[model samples]
Target: MIHSVANTDWQLASTAPLLRRGLCSLAQPLVSQTQRASRFVFAEPTIQLIVSGQLDLSTVHHHITMPASDALLFIQPHTCADIGNFRSIFLSISHSVVETLPRGFANTQTTQSISKSDSPFSTLALDADLSSALQYVISAIEDSQMSEARLRLRLQDLLMALAEKGNTFHNGNPETTTAKLRAMISEEPSKHWTAQSAGKALAMSPATLRRRLAEENTRFEHLLVDIRMHHAMMLFQTTNWHLSRIAEACGYRSTVRFNERFQERFGAVV
Candidate 1:
């Protein structure tokens, strides 16, 4: 039966699963704007769904802009990055979480029009129930007692709920104009890359690119920002490089611009 829940934070109940194969895990609201700028890097891949506000991301050749009602995914770890200005609440899971994904939901979708390869890993966003499930898990965590076993069980429930939601999200909307836009963003995410470059590469005229992206509920600059933010985060979490060096590696011509962009995108990095 579904457990009635309230907003709360709890110490996990179990360590058995964690001990068997400990997975790095940390889930919290993006703490501060500067942590947003910090080089505090993650040791593995992570994904976040913004419940509110805007987020900026930078990557190899592009920048990504992430808005509310949308999700941001990071598949691999990179060096040097920052989070832009935006107050957002999100959940983060480590690389190991991918192992728990159901089999049929795991393949890459290749039919994207603008982006020839790679797209939002999720073919469809989770349903309202899934969103509620996640919210419940966080709330449950807060209310859970300090028993280790109980904590593990709660976490398992959370993970299972998400997987179920993902399956539903995928089957419900196998096609969307937004899917094409997200796929394109996944492919290149360039800040300097304009709508023109995007259209030319996709074989659409400038006007058509604008129209198509709008129809999908997005803009070119936003996608570029999301791309950049994702890349920057990879660098921040995985590398031992200095902040300035990392920023340079991510494409900022100057450290100052990188810092500003990082906070502008992710908020103080924690």
Candidate 2:
């Protein structure tokens, strides 16, 4: 039998197999016009289903508009801004769960294919079959009486259904070189990042990095400023760190310069 437990922050439920792997499915109701933005660094990949309403997600390189009844793969860490109130179900897949799959499983193949793809993110429209399976998983997760073995079976079925939709998940090319570089820089915004230093970190020559970023309609200094400013905005919203501290954390030595740049980027005083 499936079981559900309610909590203050979210409606939480689990399957035995998934629980053993430290994965719990969650559903949350979003209020209309409630905007939330955060930086996410996922330790493992996740599959997110929009159960109701619509939301927009923005990364440094991609802006995705997810409508209701759609599914998207979040394979790496990025910043997400929810555009409006929307309800969502999140299936947090652990690394161990992937290891447990059979070598020849199509889900395994899909995972491998995605890892090899140029971009780590993709979205797919759920067909009738996949949609039905997702609804089942969502129901089973919310049902408190659902047994671990049964939930595991349901989860397996969902994976199989996804595999049947060949190339459904591998729907996009890899991110551009500049995007990758920007992700790296975002990971450590406090670092003293320069064209030469960033290029060295990405195993490219400084000149090549500059040229490629230019090809992507960005310059090194511009990209660096954008990254730093984004993080600064995040800090300002989420933390009470003083201006000097925030500036230092964003790799700015001069508070005056940091404030000037912040104002220019955000069109307001920091």
Candidate 3:
């Protein structure tokens, strides 16, 4: 079941299998006017169903709008902003889901047939079939008695419907160490993460971690800051917490330093 918070915090119920794998449900009753705009970075392919209000997301060269009841597919991660008031369900499809598809379903031929635009985002029209399928998946997630095996079947059905509607989550790119670090750090940004500590957690030596991250063209320090900044951005969007509290939650003892880092990452004052 979805729990509504009084202070506008997006409290997630992690009882569902998908919740453990990145599926997020949010229902914000009141979003402060000052909090309407903030930067966002989607680390995985996500499909957002706007339950109420509207959302406007813009990149450097593109701007798209989604009104209530519309669905949006973020095919890849990019810098963007949120506008308008909205309660939405954001589902980040994990890589493993693609492997569960029918053997030939996620292949190159399937992706090639979906669409021509290789754009990073697309708006999906919720036709009768797709809408019904989405509802099924949502209901299954909300049902506390839902079995993991049954829920997986429901999710697979929903994905199949999405594919028929020209939105497929066939990601071929291998998950990099950079992505792994971001996911790990994002879970607990307030932790005093050092290269040595992170390396130990990741089953590698500090030198090995440095070498892997260097190969990915990123450093451990950079990943930590990026995760912290992104975590702060999400808090700004989903909660009514004061800036000082948000800063402290993101691992900064000093609000001024957190503000500076947020500005540097998003190129905007939050």
Candidate 4:
């Protein structure tokens, strides 16, 4: 079954108070074989520390695999799927906090270069020192006596460690043509997107775009439909919009068609 972040059922812990204060919280969701592939969208910058197992996070423009000794910081409004059975800790930082961070905090030299594109996600290896510090933070989260102020201090320390390491923010290389195309379609799911229009936007010929996507085991139409369906599910859960409005926003002129597709994807009605 496909699970989205909007579905609160997947959340195993409660962090409402921490989230309301614009502070970070820790989540340890149990990932089983039955629900191995789960989707999530981070509205703010998030730092994920893998405590055990392997986790694969894939976005429209990037694919990141975090083993037991890796961590990541994601700073965009990108939708990703969490593939694999892994118990992990997530530290979600508010956008305001990220914006106020110093320029060098991201450790740019180790980051993968994406020409003319700005993506805020980076991968880093978990060295011994960093791992110890992360362990402390995790412990603090479980401590009943750990006040909000104290927790914030620990978070600051973690951030400092990430910045000082210098190699934790590396992205590796520019996004592939297929990844860029996927991102474009996801960003504007409401638009009447076609391979030709996407090609124009990416400054590539339609044939070239199609070929690149084929190499990635995906097609332009498939990507468009997937993006639209995902958006529709999000809206259905988060908003009280009518079915017709949802269908229109998903680039469908007919609500009937939208409902049919939605049922096909989720085995339910809107």
Q: Mind sharing the TM-score for model 1? A: 0.39
- Summing lDDT over every window of 10 consecutive residues in candidate 2, give the lowest-scoring window: 1-10
- Residue 135 displacement in candidate 4 (angstroms): 2.4
Q: If both were scored by TM-score, which would come out higher, candidate 3 or candidate 4?
A: 3
Whole-model Cα lDDT of every candidate shown, in order? 0.46, 0.60, 0.65, 0.59
* Clash pairs for candidate 3: none
Backbone clash total, candidate 4: 5
* Clashes by residue pair, model 4: 110-170, 111-170, 111-171, 112-171, 112-172
Q: Which runs in model 1 stand beyond 4 Å of their true positions?
A: 1-40, 70-80, 95-126, 144-270
Error (Å) of candidate 2 at residue 222 is 29
- Sorting all predicted structures by lDDT, with the top scorer first, yields 3, 2, 4, 1
CA shift of 114, model 4, Å: 8.8
Can you write out model 3's per-residue Cα lDDT over 1-270, one digit (the tens) per residue?
Answer: 334322123233442223433333322233445344445667655677665556677666677777665455444543354545555566655555555777655556658855455566777776668666766766677666877677777778877887766677645336677877776786678888999999998899999999999998998988899888867766666667799988898899998888899888866676
Candidate number with greatest lDDT: 3
Best-to-worst TM-score order: 3, 2, 4, 1
- Give the residue spans of candidate 3 off by over 4 A: 1-19, 22-39, 69-71, 77-87, 106-109, 114-116, 140-151, 267-270
- Please give, for residues 62-148, the per-residue lDDT of candidate 1 as tens digits: 456666553434323322344564433333343334354455442344212213423323323545565465555455444435354
How many steric clashes does model 2 contain?
A: 12
> What lDDT is reached at residue 245 by model 4?
89
Candidate 2 residue 156 C-alpha distance from true site, Å: 1.9
